[model samples]
Target: MAELSEQTGVAQSTIRSLIRGRLKRLDSISTGKLAQFFQCKLDELYVMKWE
Candidate 1:
């Protein structure tokens, strides 16, 4: 996670929040960074569930 955060320029706290399902939202820039680091499309970063 630390390595990912460093490589992606995202804070560890944000990544931790995401992993813990405590993140209410993800900004486009952060999402893009993560997607780029993971070599995936932006849409692939998260799932949409019908509530």
Candidate 2:
């Protein structure tokens, strides 16, 4: 996580929050950074479920 954070310039806390399902919302810029770090398309960064 530290490595990824450094590589992607995204904070470790943010990544942790996202992974732990604690994030209620995430902006497009952060999402884009994560997607780029993971070498995936922006749409693949997250999935939405209707509740």
Candidate 3:
């Protein structure tokens, strides 16, 4: 997370929160940004099965 945050300039806590399912919703801009950052489809950024 620290590595990713440093590379992406997004806070590690924010990334961790998203992975932990704390941020359940995503804004359109963030969706596009994250998708491009990870080099993946927009759908991949979404929480599909919510562990």
Candidate 4:
């Protein structure tokens, strides 16, 4: 987790929040960084559900 955060420039807490599904909205820049690091598309990282 620490390594990912360092490589992606995303905070560990933010990643943890994402893992725990506590984030209500996504930050495009941060999400994009994660997707780039993981070599995946942004949509593959998470899904949006209409409420």
Clashing pairs in 2: none
Give the lDDT of residue 2 in candidate 3: 77
**Top model by lDDT, which number?**
4
Q: For residues 1-51, could you state the per-residue lDDT of candidate 2 as single tens digits?
A: 999898878889998988767775668888788888878864444553222
lDDT tens digits by residue: candidate 1, 1-51: 999999999999998887666775779899888878979864454553212
Q: lDDT of model 4 at residue 10?
A: 93
Give the alpha carbon lDDT tens digit for every residue of 1-51 in model 4.
Answer: 999999999999998887667874568989888888989864655654222
TM-score of each predicted structure versus truth: 0.70, 0.68, 0.60, 0.71
| Cand. 1 Cα-lDDT | 0.78
Candidate 2 lDDT at 11 equals: 86
Q: lDDT for every model?
A: 0.78, 0.75, 0.67, 0.79
Give the local distance difference test score of model 2.
0.75
lDDT of 3: 0.67
The best-first sequence of candidates by TM-score reads 4, 1, 2, 3
Judged by TM-score relative to the true structure, which candidate is superior, 1 or 4? 4
lDDT: worst 10-residue window of model 4? 42-51
Summing lDDT over every window of 10 consecutive residues in candidate 1, give the lowest-scoring window: 42-51
Look at candidate 2 and tell me the lDDT of residue 20. Answer: 69
